[model samples]
Target: MWHSLVRADNLFGPRHALTAVHQQLDVLQGLLEDSRGEYRHEVLRLSAQYAESAAWLHEDSMDMASAETWTSRAMEWAMEAGDEAMLPWTLFRRSQLAAGKRNAGQTIGLAQAVQRHERALTRPMKAAAIQQEAQGLVLDGDESACHRKMDEVHEYAASVDSSGDARSGHGDFCTPSYIEIQRANCWLNLDRPDRAVDTFQTALAELPDVYQRDRGFAQARLAIAYVGIREYEQAAAEAAAVLDMARGSGSGRTLQEAVTAGNALAAESNVPAVRDLLDAVKESAGF
Candidate 1:
């Protein structure tokens, strides 16, 4: 139900979906209060999921404080459940949240903890840990370390046989597309605009239509790369496409990226396409 609400809110511009989720969370909290000890664990797990969903929503909206609060709550619940694997996964999310805020120190610290806790992790988890480390390194401006970590991520990912259920902290959440997107992000942060564009294009080629929001996100990153390269025409084109897809999707993160890119272009002051794109962003930002 929470997933459905998140999808609906993301795909459609419906504020009511968020309200519904909050109502459901309230009910779940009441139920947890009345549940027994054995059931408490299950309740905690559900609470964690709720918190995670809330964090995603808040992050999309650029509500960093709310996002952090919910993500922290999710981690606390996962720890209470005594799920060692989930602890690292939640820490990874926190690292990502910090990175989004451009807090390099926090991102690096959380990412290192993820790697440290990966001793008992399976192949996929190790790949994810590497990916997080790469992200942190990128934010910290450690170009060599970032590239090396990305290589390790690819190497680890390539070794994972898909014959059995890929044992990891995240299970089905650790999909190939996820890794590809992470790599694309790393390329973008490293100022490899051409590489970032290529990676995103490749991922989009095999990506399903159901994941439109994810695709929009990738395009937003690609647009940023275009902006970095001073390719105003391409940046405007991609930013427009992303805005069209994100119209009703309540994805604050995607919108924020678009806004940031537009702001950058606007600051350039000489690009007409960029000015037009900035106008579009202002409309979408509803500010």
Candidate 2:
């Protein structure tokens, strides 16, 4: 269910997936309240997952308070589950929320705090923490430190194997494609869109089609890189790809990036593809 729930976040986006999770959680929560035998721990485990997913969706939906509430609830259930596996993950999500808010210091602090619990972390979670710290460094405008952190990310990436744990985090997909995409994102944050464009293209091509929604997001990032370099034609084409995928996925993230790219292009000279992409972006805004 965790696997499918994460997939739904990528495929159908937050707003759509949250509805399903909420329905399932309502029943599960009730059953959990009554059960107190062998299955109690199991229910707690499942409850933790549902709460974590809800927190993620709420964060994406721009409901920070709800996100915080669910995240805290997830931590409680995780603590009851006794494995303590979800502790690092819950902290990781909080770091992500800080990053989303663009609070670089808070992002770095939370990510560093995750690293402090290094003994409890899985390999995948370690990689995620390092990458997140790098993102914070980028936001701090520390190019050298950010690049160094990415090197750390690559080292951990090599240790990453074909394990299910690698795929648990919301944005941290734990595939090689995901690493490549993060590399591109680093370049993007560092304002080296020229470098980012190629890396993003590589990541997009390498991404497993099973992660359908992720492909859309990579395309949107690629489009932005193109726009950054004034390669309006390529930007237009990439934006078109994002729009096509977003139509199927209803990805708010994809739509948000598409809107940004479209507005960027609007300021420059116009082409038919550019105009078409912009119009399509406007259409998807309703999603």
Candidate 3:
């Protein structure tokens, strides 16, 4: 069931994924109410997992209120089940939500809370928490501190086996490529899109094909990098590709980034390609 949810999230849109998770949650609730003892505890843990999945779907869809509600429920279930590992992971997820809101202080504080449970956290979890904190540092414009934290994140990530603990279900996405892509995003935030272009290209090349959303996101950012350097043609090309992905996947996050690239290219609307790309974006976005 968990594997299905993961695959659905990768291949389908947030609306589809959320529907599946909610159906699973309904079944889990019935099982939880009927079972007792260790079996009930296991059911509770599974419920927490589904709830967290829903939280992530909501966040990616840019539905902050639903995301917050689901995340809080996941945390509550994790605590009730006495799942120590999940408790910290929930905190890490909250940090991501804070980062989405651009709340540097809250993001950093929640990530630090995740780190405080180091004994319960897997190495990948540690790396994820640290990487998230570095994003907060980027928001604060602390380039040096962000780099230092990224170094620490890589150290933790390096210790994970090559398989990246996919079955272990802890920080499976904290692979080297994921970390590097995040660093490229930070570079963009720091107004170093010149450096970001090369970094994003390298990371995207190494990124697995299974990560459709990730690919679209990186491509969207790469479009922004081209726009930053006044490469309107390349930016338009990338934006067109990202728009296709966004339409196919219905990924609000990817769509948002693609829209950003479109807006950035608007200044060069005199260029035929740029004008066409803007028209496409406007048509897709319905604004």
Q: What Cα-based lDDT does every candidate model obtain? A: 0.72, 0.78, 0.85
Candidate 3 lDDT score at position 232: 93
Better of 2 and 3 by TM-score: 3
Per-residue lDDT of model 1, residues 86-154, tens digit only: 678788789888788788888888878887886656667767777777788888889888878777775
Give one digit per residue, the lDDT tens place, for model 3 in 1-287.
Answer: 67766766765656567888989999998898899988888998999998998898888787889899999999998998999988999999999998988999999999999999978988888999999999999999999999899878887773324332145566877877789999999999999999899899998988766566778888999999989988999998998898876776657888888889999988899998899999999888752
Count clashes in each candidate, considering only residues at least 3 apart in sequence or on different chains.
5, 0, 0
The alpha-carbon RMSD values of the candidates against the true structure, listed in the order shown, are 4.0, 2.8, 2.1
* Residue-level lDDT for 76 in candidate 3: 95
For model 2, the run of ten residues with the poorest summed lDDT: 157-166
List residue ranges in candidate 1 displaced over 4 A: 2-17, 119-123, 155-173, 267-275, 285-287
Q: Any residue pairs clashing in model 1, and if so which?
A: 10-249, 12-248, 13-248, 60-252, 60-253
* Candidate 2 residue lDDT tens string, 240-267: 8777666565556676787788889996
Clashes of 3: 0
Instruction: Summing lDDT over every window of 10 consecutive residues in candidate 3, give the lowest-scoring window.
Output: 158-167
TM-score of every model versus the real structure:
0.82, 0.88, 0.93
Predicted structure with the largest TM-score when compared to the true one: 3
* Deviation (Å) of 28 in candidate 1: 1.6
